[model samples]
Target: MSGGVDSAVAAARAVEAGHEVVGVHLALSRAGGTLRTGSRGCCTIEDAMDARRVADRLGIPFYVWDFSERFRDDVIEDFVSEYRAGRTPNPCMRCNERIKFAALLERALELGFDAVCTGHYAILRDGENGLELHRSSEEAKDQSYVLGVLTADQLAHCLFPLGETPSKALVRAEAEARGLAVASKPDSYDICFIPDGDTRGWLAEKVGTAPGEIVDRSGAVVGSHDGAHAFTVGQRKGLRLGVPAPDGKPRFVLEVRPVSNTVVVGPREALAIAELAGARFTWAGTAPDAPHEEFACDVQVRAHADPVPAVAVVRDGELVIRPDEPLHGVAPGQTAVVYAGTRVLGQCTIDRTVSAVPAAV
Candidate 1:
């Protein structure tokens, strides 16, 4: 339990189902004493206490596992490295992939646990092929995108008790009925490590600023930024470019070349991506047999973003996604989750993209 209402209620439901359940809260960082200024952080001391209280109420043993070092190496360092490589990464997905499912699940299994349960809002079903991951009944709260990196073996030993829970309010109501104190706890919305949500500031402290030139699509220097790492593809607001485009149209960040410390800005249309190629692909269940070279599926590039119809193919050791329609702002290092309707097929880390706009000679 993350010391939240949903997880508390999930524990309750799991216990009610007549299964022996123990609550395990992960201590992800050394900043345990840090106060949660807003409802956008997890693993704080307050959250741990809340989780302990819920475990007490549920009559289950609770333990706080310290995984700070592993988290820093896998998730935090990965975040920094991806940004330094001029790519935007979803650290939450990395946390789910590396820490929660891999590290915690392995530990739980060694302790004779049949499965690791969490409060994620995704459905697990036994399909003909094997176990399948599906979106939650609550569409708005669906988290299958983040969990898409799990392999078939991982999905087999996982349980999500809140997948069918109609809504967040219902989970809170269940928590209240069970006399849980965290029924009204605000949901965490920001990156857990960056509690204050000042990503740029936090990154700047870790990766020192390097002055860089901001050039337009035509290779003309339009402005300058403190660092290319501070910007991301599809970003528009913070460019602070002093010059306007010749066509008098607003420009967007088209690319971040960290090697040369250059930020490329251009017309918004330049951000449109017609296809994407991803490496490190993982299937949630069994990889389906492809009679042909390509198959049809829905691809979601970001959490909470709508999945777009696409054609998928594995060629040259990369999962290639060709969206039926153009997708904008697809950056390297972001996850591209594939799904067939509501069933999550798998996901891969985007390595590159094919822009819709032709390159200038």
Candidate 2:
């Protein structure tokens, strides 16, 4: 259990299902707590203690595994590097794919456990032949986006106990009835390592002071920013630009050119995107065997963001996605997840926006 309400209820469900369950909190960190003390993050010792308490209340065994070093090297460091490369990174997905399900699951299976169970809001079913990944009854809290990277073999070896319950209400009732301490804890949605959701501050801390320029589409120097690391694609407010468009309207950030230390600010219409090129795609429920089959799906470029209709063509290992309805503000280094209804088909890391939407939209 991750020392949270959902996981607590998940544990209760497992116990009700008559399955022996053990709760383990992963100890992963780098600079310090993954989030502020009260915020949602696994790095805090308090979260570990919370997981232990859940184990105690549930009458199950609990242990804390120290994987801090590995987490830093694999997740945090990679997050920093991806931002530096002008790409947004999904550290949570990385943690799930690397530490939790990959490393910890393997260790658990090696220790003779039948499977490693999690509180993820996705269904696992006994299909015609084996376990299948399905949409959770709880659509709002469906975390199938991050878990989409798992392989079929991995799904066969895993268990998700809270798949059928809608998260915000049903999960709460389950936890409250059980009298668990974390029954009402609010869910965390920001980056774990960056408290206050300030990724620019974290990048500044790691990359030192690298100055950059802010210019318009015509390459006119409009403003000078502190550092290119402090900006991202589609950003607007902090551009510190004193310039206005011909219509006397405010401008927004259009690009972050790290190589030349430039932050481009322009009209909001410049942010629309129609196509995107991504690499390192991993499909979950099913893998599209060919390019024609792959591109025939809708995709999401960010979490909690709407999934626009799209098609994918997997060239070699890279999947290039073209959205049917123009998607605005497509950013590099962000994840583009594809889905069909509630089922997660696959996802890829964004490389660049090739076809963008019309500015008016």
Off by over 4 Å in 2: 30-36, 126-131, 292-295, 357-361
Candidates' lDDT values, in order? Answer: 0.91, 0.75
Best by TM-score: 1
lDDT of 1 by residue, 1-361 (tens): 8899988988999999999999999998886477676797888888999999999999999999999999999999999999999999999999999999999999999999999999999999999988999999999999999999999999989999999987988998888899999999999988988989899999999999988899987789999999899999999898888898888988899999999999998888888999998878988998857713899999999898999999999888888899999999999999999999999988999999999988672
72 Cα displacement, candidate 2 (Å): 0.1
Clash pairs for candidate 1: none
* Model 2 per-residue lDDT tens digits across residues 8-105: 88788888889988888877764443444456444466677777888899899888888888888889899888877766678888888888888888
Q: What's the true lDDT of residue 249 in model 1?
A: 84
Cα TM-score of candidate 1: 0.98
TM-score of each: 0.98, 0.92
State the local distance difference test value for candidate 1: 0.91
